[model samples]
Target: MLGVTDYGAFVIAFLLLLAIPGPGNFALITATGKGGIKGGLAATCGVILGDQVLMWLAVAGVATLLAAYPAAFHVVQWAGAAYLAWLGLRMLLSKPGGAPRTTRMDSGQYLRQTMMITLLNPKAIMFYMAFFPLFVDPVHHQGMITFAFMAVTVAALTLLYGLVAVLLTHHLAERMRASPKMANLLERLAGACLVGFGIKLAAMR
Candidate 1:
């Protein structure tokens, strides 16, 4: 319906994309670990908002512009990579038993920070531009309706994923709170992953 072909396939593809480890996931988990459910939900909202913006930009042909301008794409890619790497390094160097700086931020700050992270990644824009078209039939396209449906679908799935992540991370955080050493180790691990993702993004063509 809504001029979307293979709706089931779209859901599956979106879910798979969400499951991939990335800066967004790292931010969600870290926020939950520090600020509990409230922080996690705030970050979730930020991600959803950012994704909607990117998806619509794709629909508006921003992706094509980026493709035509390699320099612009590279600039965004490098900025995203640098941001991730910097955050990771800060976390890695944080004193043991200290909470991640992200956790220290209030809810509004958390939302904005996550939104920025979500918006910075050029890969996400590319994914939306490529992925959305696969399920959109140009001949039967309902224009805004089709785009709206896809946007709603993405938001719903992302909320579900974020809810689950928040719950799980919060649970772990509670347990870790009892053991400072364990919490520190987990934070360090998350930091290392973010660093690795940053490096990978920077190296992407």
Candidate 2:
């Protein structure tokens, strides 16, 4: 069982990570901006689920496989990067050209995109590699417990960020109905970030 110190340290680390602006936060914000609270929540769920699955895989030795087979990691990294860039480009090019529509994404689509967004993030893999090991204690046999704690922490933070996205997007969308300038800018910035991140991931030694 994790003690008070373990929980405290975990909270601090989780908050610090949550505060960072990354793919997950970007997705949440974008989704909410487009679809309001429901969309934001959908994306948030996807991120939390993906994070947990990756965390478990890491604990179960996938991280070791990644370390041993650097080529495979690069493949996944590049693929993820490409996907992120594509999404970013789509956002950059989107316009209110068609019949303007507003609706929350369906469950299947939301889950699929959310998973894609989270899994394609090479930084997330690195994050798990660096963060998960910090709490592991060989003497404690607390691997599963620690993983669960981390998963919950991520879920909580994702939900919090999702709410923020929903609120912010709701306001932004209302104010800027026909304007694509801001969306295009954000999409381009996100795409650039993803491309850069991809190159970094591919080049990691």
Candidate 3:
């Protein structure tokens, strides 16, 4: 059985990490702004799929294997960290919301970006790798049972956060579109948050 403290810590850490706007969050917001609630929700589903893949991979010992090989693990971690840093920089530099452009978001783009964003995120991989071991008492519960619990918890959280972001973007789309200054500020804040998270992940033992 998982300890209450472990579960609480996992929830807090996961939610805090997700709260920081990154490529995934920005993508969701942009989709909401462009296509309203329905479109945003659809894109969010793609994100959920990407997360689900990672969750399973973690439970399968992929993260453990990567952790075992120091050189290879460092290579993967650095690459992921660099990718996240690049995303943060890009978000910081991007122009604010503008008039709805003719460029329509397609399913392909949605899936591709969602997968890339989640998979490329070293911080996220590290998080699950670190988090799952805490609550999992494989001696007490089956490995699959623990993994299933964690996966379901994460999926539900994703849905909640995605919907919250979608609603916020939808509610303020027009105002956000008009305020370049606010957009730039949000971009900077989000970028800083990602960079900070990356640093924290990199520093972890």
Best by TM-score: 1
Off by over 4 Å in 2: 1-4, 96-107, 137-141, 178-205
Q: Report the C-alpha lDDT of model 2 over 1-205, residue by residue, as the tens digit.
A: 4422366677678877776877667767666666666777777788878888787777677877887887888788888877766665665454534322323456555657778878876556667877766766656656567667667776787677667767877788767656666555654566566556556655655
Residue pairs with backbone atoms closer than 3 Å in model 3 (clashes): none
Overall local distance difference test of candidate 1: 0.89
- Measured over all alpha carbons after superposition, the RMSD of each candidate to the real structure, in angstroms, is 1.2, 3.1, 4.4
lDDT of 3: 0.69
Name the weakest run of 10 consecutive residues (lDDT summed) in model 2. Answer: 95-104
Q: Which stretches of candidate 3 lie over 4 Å from their true place?
A: 1-13, 20-23, 78-103, 137-139, 179-205
Using lDDT, give the best candidate's number.
Answer: 1
For model 1 the TM-score comes to: 0.95
Write down the TM-score of every candidate.
Answer: 0.95, 0.80, 0.68
lDDT of each: 0.89, 0.68, 0.69
Candidate 1, residues 126-155, lDDT tens digits: the string is 889888889998889999999999999999
The lDDT, on a scale of 0 to 1, for candidate 2 is: 0.68
- For model 1, what is the alpha-carbon lDDT of residue 105? 85
